[model samples]
Target: MDFAGTDAAEKATYSTLTALMYRACEPIDDDTSVLARVVGCSVRTFKKSLEQLIRKKLILQLENGNLWSVQIEEELKNCNENLNRLSERAIKAANTKRNKQKDNSSREHDEVMTTSSRGHDNIMMSSSRQHINNNIYNKKLKLSF
Candidate 1:
């Protein structure tokens, strides 16, 4: 699956934090140093990762460095799924619209061709009738021998 945000290292750190949240049933109220030791990261790195998770809405930091709401991961997953579904629907709608436009254009072209063919046929018939009339008039002409 595609991950949101920066590189693999950040993602790995985020995963570690999530694992820590999941493993612990209740909210954690430990110091940053202890948390860093638990996640095997430097204290500064742990603090930065925690901030990133909060910024990304993947975790909620409560009062006094307490963290809660591990269900945020599930929520994020659901949101991503919905977004993908909506994107697919939008693509289908656009394709359907394009097809309808193509069909309408083809129908309009066919109608114009049919009308032009009828007009050409009418002109040919009128010219033929005039020619026949001239032939009859020539045959009726009188000449002295």
Candidate 2:
């Protein structure tokens, strides 16, 4: 909001800060020429804006000539950690669902096997009764003859 007023220098400084933050977790090189091009400003103007941001302690210049924003880095780290936790939870849920399905499948298979065994026993008993009946009928016919 401070950069929203009619101050062009503040706008440029805001743009520089935004560009640095846009690099996500990585630090940008302290190259004013390249940064000026990115911010659509002259190198002198970019340096002035950069100096303003540094003075405000909004941007950090590391010893390796890299510019960084600690807030952005911390935000990106938190986001990554959240994504990792969510991914792990998703994987665990999938495995639990798969195991439940497997258990159900095994139970269904056991039930089917039990029912089939019972059906087989019934068929064998019916066949044995039919054979006995045929033998009794044949014996009766022979005695009448």
Candidate 3:
């Protein structure tokens, strides 16, 4: 909005405010000189802009020597909460999909095992029949001799 300063001063104030918002509740170096350098402005200009912002109630200097924007802080908190909710939902969906895949794999394994067991039983029965037929043919040969 109306920062009430020269163009450079307004730009400095806007830059400083933006930097604080990027920090997201973390404190920044409150030294005016350091802040001026960060915002690419003279220390005097930065201080004047800061005062105007304070008088306008657009920014607050906390007791901990950090600057805060009430509007930005609230918005950041809301964004963080929404991100957490979406993350939880995504994790839950992934787990459900993994479980379904595991169940399908287990079912497939069981079907294979059952088929193998039936094949083994059939092989044993076939072998037993062959042995009985051979014995009968040998007895018949002895009787004919």
Candidate 4:
């Protein structure tokens, strides 16, 4: 939930972590640069996830600086599910905000048009004698943005 990093939570980090977990059954090299490439993220990004895994006690860092899992394989399995849920919720919230703004703008526009129409009707109601008084008076249509 609080996956904040200085710049970004960086989905790449999560992805790299998942890759590391899946491959935990394999022997770990002291360096994770090769696995980092396989996960399609930078070594720095992969390192961050590895650090998090250690911090969360989901993984243990050996004295030799190699990585090992701590019964977190099942948790790693849900990474994709978590990412999907997060994406869906974010999109839904964004769409809801957009729709609310559209509805508000439409209501404002309708109010302005209704006021204009009412003003036109009022003018017509009293203007027959005025039209006879002023031959030069003409109704001008207003355009609104």
**Candidate-wise lDDT, in order:** 0.75, 0.79, 0.78, 0.68
Please state the error at residue 37 of candidate 4 in Å: 22
For 49-113, candidate 2 gives per-residue lDDT tens digits of 77777767667888998888776777888999999999999999999999999999999999999
Q: Tens digit of lDDT per residue, candidate 1, span 2-119? A: 3666555457666766666666645667577887877777888877877776777666887766776557557556877999999999999999999999999999999999999999
Candidate number with the higher TM-score (2 or 3): 3
10 residues in a row with least lDDT, candidate 2: 1-10
In angstroms, give how far residue 55 of model 1 lies from its true place: 18
TM-score winner between 1 and 2, please give it.
Answer: 2
* lDDT, candidate 3, 5-56, per-residue tens: 4477766676677666677465455688877787878889888888877767
* Model 3 backbone overlap count: 0
User: Among all windows of ten consecutive residues in candidate 4, which has the lowest summed lDDT?
Assistant: 1-10
Q: Each candidate: RMSD to true structure?
A: 11.9, 4.0, 3.3, 15.9
Which parts of model 2 are misplaced by more than 4 Å? 1-6, 12-21, 127-145
In model 1, how large is the Cα lDDT of residue 102? Answer: 100
Write model 4 residue lDDT over 1-145, tens digit each, in one string.
Answer: 3455523434555445545657664436646778677666778877786677568665577788766554454456577689899999999999999999999999999999999999998999779767776765665668999
The TM-score measured for candidate 2 stands at 0.72
Using lDDT as the measure, what is the rank order of every candidate, best first?
2, 3, 1, 4
Q: What is the TM-score of each predicted model, taking all chains together?
A: 0.44, 0.72, 0.79, 0.39
Residue 2 local lDDT, model 4: 43
State how far residue 9 of model 4 sits from its true place (Å). 30
